[model samples]
Target: MKRSVLLLLGILLIVLGVVSIGALKREIRISTNVTVSKSEATSFRVLSSAEQISSWMEGITLQETLVEHPENVGSRYRLTQVDGSEWEATVLDLEDNRRIVMLLTDPRAEIHIEVELFPSPEGTRVQIDTITRGSTVFYRTLMPFAKRSILKSQMRINEHWKRLIETSIESLVGEWSGTDASGSEQLFEFHFDGTADWKVSSSAGEFQLKNLLYRRNTLSQPQQLDLTGFQKGPLAGMTLFGIVDLSRQDTLIYDAAAGKPDDASARPETFSESATVYIRIR
Candidate 1:
């Protein structure tokens, strides 16, 4: 009787293993969409550019081209994540200003991503579809529990891209002035060449305007101005990250506070704080 019981247990284990292996081999697909306030051509341009793609995907340090091509099809890239993980991606298909399909090769699994852009009255509607299959039995068993988180991450990526395409550099060029929470006078000058100047006056007297390199923060919510100081001044060699809201064509609301840098070597000594409503002075 004991021998029979042991044999049955072994058979049960083998059956469970087979079931797990089969489940792991199953493919799953997820789809999501986001709307951006830009023409389809503009949106497609941003999506295809490696630099812009890296900026839109938060925590991705950079993407280096392994193989480059003018047509974009067959182009391969190596993506480096913030955590130092790496992945290989290849452009499987490309339709100018319409669609892009990419294959991501990772150790755990292989994923295919398809992006489609449609023109809308508000701007461009971006649809993203991702499909993947688990490669290992352990990974397959975890897929059911992990699938939701994976879909959420894809949604977040789309949202980041949407925010970035909506607030291009062209929309930010000009002069704006406002008052801080402390009733201090604040002024900002954004140039077409991607440079900016900021000045603020408070009880401590007026601070000199510092030259800054400004770019759109693609990773942040509601979109914001990413300012990197250039010369030696109060904000020299520092980043003043701030949120920008266009209340109207003529009015802008800006808010920012101090924060620590992710890289210790790049940390700055001083920073500034402000929450002001700016009117276009230009």
Candidate 2:
């Protein structure tokens, strides 16, 4: 009877081991592309260039720059994160204003980042292909979970890129200032109940535009918003909507699709029509 019991336990263990192995073998893949339309190649070219890489990729800020000069094919650069951890990457291929591929590594983790750029009806379509392969038994087991989490985070990251790209657009063509463009002298001062201010604006007449967004972090109660809208004409009913990242440096304005006019402020669903100063900052 003891021998039969031991044999039964051994079979169950083998079946569990088989199931675990099958689970680990399953793979998850995610891909995303964002296009900035009608943009000159210069914008994409400058971003991929070595000189301004850090401006867009904030993570590079935490690393120590161990290599300098143009990162051409076969060139390598080393960086160390804040915790004294390190990553070494080498440029594997480059085509001016078209594509770039690099292999990234730290002592424990490895990722390949490929950036491809092409013209689109709206602007330039930037395809970022990221394949992270882990070498150790632990990281290999963790890769699929990591990949799933990272893909969700990518959506938020794209929104960040949208804010930056919108900023770039405004830098190229000045903002559609309220008074001159829309004939409204609305003294819009969006002082959040906390500390942070950054937004995107596009001025195309008679079109709905999502002008501003703000977020705040507070311990006393739920965060809040304060806006002073000034307009008496057609845009008096226009509304503003946005998302605020408590941990981020900027807010994302949910403008309508790039080609279409922005959404008007009066949408009852997921929009607030009134603007009032809950607290005055003297």
Regions of candidate 1 where Cα sits further than 4 Å from its true position:
1-25, 55-58, 169-282
**Candidate 1 — worst ten consecutive residues by lDDT sum?**
263-272
lDDT by residue (tens digit), candidate 2, 1-282: 999999999998986665565357443355777766424333444444454433332345453345554435665666644556657777677664567777777766676777777766676677877776666665565665576676866666555655555444211111112232334322223321212232323343243223333332233122322221313343353433322212221222222111112542332223233321121111
Give candidates' CA RMSD values in order: 14.9, 17.4
Cα-based lDDT at residue 249, candidate 1: 49
The lDDT values for all models are 0.70, 0.46
Query: Model 2: residues >4 Å from true position, as ranges?
Result: 1-28, 38-40, 51-60, 69-71, 165-282
How much is the lDDT of residue 111 in candidate 1? 78
